[model samples]
Target: MGSLVVFSPLFFFVLAIQMSSLMVSLSQEGFCSAPPILNAADSTAQPLYWKVTNPTLSPSHLQDLPGFTRSVYKRDHALITPESHVFSPLPDWTNTLGAFLITPAMGSHFVMYLAKMQENSKSGLPLRDVERFVFVLHGTVFLTDVSGVTHSLNVDSFAYIPPNSTHHIKCDASSTLVVFERRYSYLESHYTDLIIGSTDKQPLLETPGEVFELRKLLPTSLPYDFNIHIMDFKPGEFLNVKEVHYNQHGLLLLEGQGIYRLGDSWYPVQAGDSIWMAPFVPQWYAALGTSRSRYLLYKDVNRNPL
Candidate 1:
């Protein structure tokens, strides 16, 4: 008993270390927990959309400005739809003109948004429903949602609206926001036309968290596992340990910093980083700074094709 007691703490310490490493490994391997069933502990399992914080400029928030510098992936661009294009076809970030990274288009699903904005414009030109997101390296803008949620956005600020949700904006300020064009499955079309003037109450759906510009890291047409999600990890927050049966992960780092371990390589990633890993890549990481490490995380919840 004496020998056992002395070794017990060490055993637990080793176990804890192993457990943390294993947790990250599993996440990297695309081993994510299944979405809970209806009525279970987390029955809803709906996507939680985070609202953009800090609309007004405060002295304390001044230092948060990311350098005007930007990064772009140097890869061939692929056209996904009528409005969206994929690839790192833009100029390098080191250029004085700044970088231009295009996101997959927001296709015709949300045409009402563009139409409303056009109606308000002097030319009254109709806009397409497709939405696209782009990261802004500098400046600010005035943003107003359909419900009159008015606010001033600054550099690095993010804006997100639910599919079919109406919003209007004016970038006549010093703020530059990366616009992420998100095109949802449009599972329901009833709300598509409820733009700037709808008497009906907003029918809410699971919305993705709000952050700077972002687009679907994975192709929409690709019949991936039915249940996939993307989220930003705040410093130190991690996905708990769980077993996963699926493989194939698509990850993109949007902002901040972190080192992601995929397979044998520890890829140090920051804004504009992306990785496509095969099944069982044994992934995980820790945030490298006080700001949250934001990324577009995609995993096949079901179905595995070689």
Candidate 2:
């Protein structure tokens, strides 16, 4: 009986080990609890960003991670690398949407995408109530309206679509395009005609020697609540002043390197960088490298007081 008691504990330990191994195997074979369903428990299945905790951990009031100099947005965050890009394939089209600003997480009003579409891929502009702007970054984007008018936009080309317009976009060659959309709001006497232009073809206007002078893309006559500019800065030149404005700006750094003074902080930005600066957040920038610095700029303007 004494020998049996000693062996009994060993036998039970072996049995427990076997049971653990079986449970792990069963879990691996999909026999355990069901995994979280995509688009079931939350609006987004994958975690988009890492939360910040300064000195405390709280769900209701998380902080932006340190590394910013001084920021107006307590919720400010940035994706400093290309791998930080968030892309999901559109279900309707095989093309990919590299969305940077999505929904309420984005400030105020715009849905932006760095879209990749191959030749013969088609996409429709926002139909009834949305307006769209497409800037061709590489290759060819062919825009055709319902009236049969077609516009072929190449590298550095831009187009504006009005609200309620029946228009479609086709990529004749595999291309990368930046698509920006906003809800259409019009004022009486709003000049609503479509405009097409190219940064390569248009003469650089209103710029003084190597200074950052931005030439406007859309004619001021158009009643757009927003404006776009192809801005330039010579090497070692900066905005030259600390300024704050009521306008929010979206800047896509197209060429060269620079220092951006945003929301009371300084950041070194380079080509292919996209920046979103909220309205009234103090900002400025200076070109750093030997090459001329350039960026495609978007500014919200002419809106009634909130």
lDDT of 1: 0.36
**Candidate 1, position 256, lDDT:** 51
**RMSD, model 1, all Cα superposed?**
15.5
Q: Rate the local accuracy (lDDT) of all candidates.
A: 0.36, 0.62
Compute the lDDT of residue 303 as modeled in candidate 1.
Answer: 33
lDDT of 1 by residue, 1-306 (tens): 355435454465345455545544553453433122123233224222111121111223224343312222222211111111122311321111211233223111111111011112211111244333322334545557667877654444444444445565555433323333334433332222211211112232333443222233323333322222345567665544322333544444544555554443344444444454444445665555445666544443323344
Clash number for each model? 25, 0
Off by over 4 Å in 2: 1-81, 91-96, 102-104, 207-210
Candidates in order, TM-scores: namely: 0.36, 0.70
The most accurate candidate by lDDT is 2
**Candidate 1: residue 58 lDDT (0-100):** 21
- Give lDDT for model 2: 0.62
**Candidate 2 C-alpha error for residue 194, in Å:** 1.3
